[model samples]
Target: MTAAKPIRCLAFDTSMTCPGVAIIEVRKGKPTIKALSHVKPNTSRSHAHRAEVIEGWAMLFLDKHVGTAGFDYVVREDFAGKTSRSNYPVLSAWNACERATSRFGLTFAKYKKPGKDTEYLGISATRVKSLVAGSGNAVKDEVEAGVRRITGYAGTFANDDESDAAAIGLAWLIDAGVIEKPKGAG
Candidate 1:
């Protein structure tokens, strides 16, 4: 539990099980968590009626966060690019992110090492695991343990996707230099 940063940011997660949005504003040494939302998604394996709902939800989220001042960047979970799998939920998440960025005119990006030219950086699952937990090959239980240790939430928060999304946001916050890096590691 270190000090937060004086930076404003919005993070989102879109999928069949969990859809979430969070807005964190930091300024003048004052950090404010303005908004955080998570709802059970109305989705299906085939992505039934998902695009329309995503558009609507993304519009609402944008209205809430990017009303007058647009967000600096939009961060979403990046699919591992496994062409063999037919994960409609994963595709839906990617598509929803794409739609959100286009709808709000927000730039999409990832934090890749030594690559600053493109907005989309190569963030992989191993990196996320390591960033959220201590090891790249950490299991879900380990991730939840790290998250609980970091956030100090209750027992019900275990295995929740929203909590994982928040951890991902925290990772980006630290990576972007928006927040102070974790102790003993960068």
Candidate 2:
């Protein structure tokens, strides 16, 4: 018998200052992190320049991977809807990601903050943590540790942003049934 093909997923944790991105492959229902990186925008640059930098990087990453095996899914962690006043940059970056994903003819999923509603398709943050870290209340460090443990990834991440991207990808895999839910998960 031949083995089934793996599902490829690209995930992002978006921010104005630093955004994280990861590519994962699910083979035999186990997810492996293929690549992970964080993009830091130059703070001294104007908003337009920073946006251009982010958009360029995002497109380059997608172009590099989308031509490979092609992705089965794309996901981005949704921002916490605290107040509309402070979320413009995040929303802008997220919109760029959405546009890039659409350009590749792929539909991306947005994992939302718990119990919040938004126009975009969203899954709650609690659910993501539960699926990825085995606890809905898991902190950033714990979530990062869980990702490391799950993928056996040895490389160091610049910050929790990268790890969070990995976690977001894992959550999507779990939600898609590409990966099994971990024990004690909420």
Candidate 3:
């Protein structure tokens, strides 16, 4: 059989207040983290201001790192909370991400369809935790530990936000059959 080509993925733990980001590259079924970061938008302003800030940040980030053809696809953690307070940030983040990705012409075009699809996806936090940490209810610390264990990342994650994004990326790779599931992960 022939070897599989490398696939790069950009994933986000998105929020208007602070959005975490991670890029994962898979070569021959092994995963590596290419970059990781998070942005804290000025919260003293209105939601519109926060959304614009997020959109600007995402656009700049994609332009610099992703360009026109950087990764295979982008994935964000699905909003999985009951609080209405969380709605503004999540919606704003998704809108900004969509706008940024659309600007870059990045969509869920794994098949390279002909027309404008403009599709993206979100992996649930429970599913991400389950796949990465072997438990759906795993907490932030455990998810961080699991991500470190899987990616062999030595440095500490600035916060769980970054780790969660990394976990989401890794889990997407595994779920899509792009990479084999890491040992001891669910």
Candidate 2 shows a clash count of 0
Give the per-residue lDDT digits (tens) of candidate 1, residues 51-108. Answer: 5576567677677767776666567655555563556666766676677668777866
Off by over 4 Å in 3: 1-4, 67-69, 80-84, 108-121
Task: lDDT for model 3, please.
Answer: 0.79
TM-score of each: 0.71, 0.86, 0.85
Cα shift from native, residue 15, model 2 (Å) = 0.8
lDDT, candidate 2, 1-186, per-residue tens: 988888998988887788889998988777888988778999898656777777778888888878758888788776666777567787877877777777878887654444556544545567778888888899998898788777888888889888988898888887767787777666
Q: Candidate 1 regions off by >4 Å?
A: 1-6, 28-32, 43-45, 114-122, 138-159, 184-186
lDDT of each: 0.60, 0.80, 0.79
Report the C-alpha displacement of residue 57, candidate 2, in angstroms.
0.7
The TM-score leader among the candidates is 2
For candidate 1, give the lDDT of residue 125. Answer: 50
Residues 117-158 of candidate 3: C-alpha lDDT, one tens digit per residue: 643357677778988998889999898888887778887677
Off by over 4 Å in 2: 110-120
Cα lDDT, model 3, residue 81: 59
Superposition error at 141 for model 1 (Å): 6.3
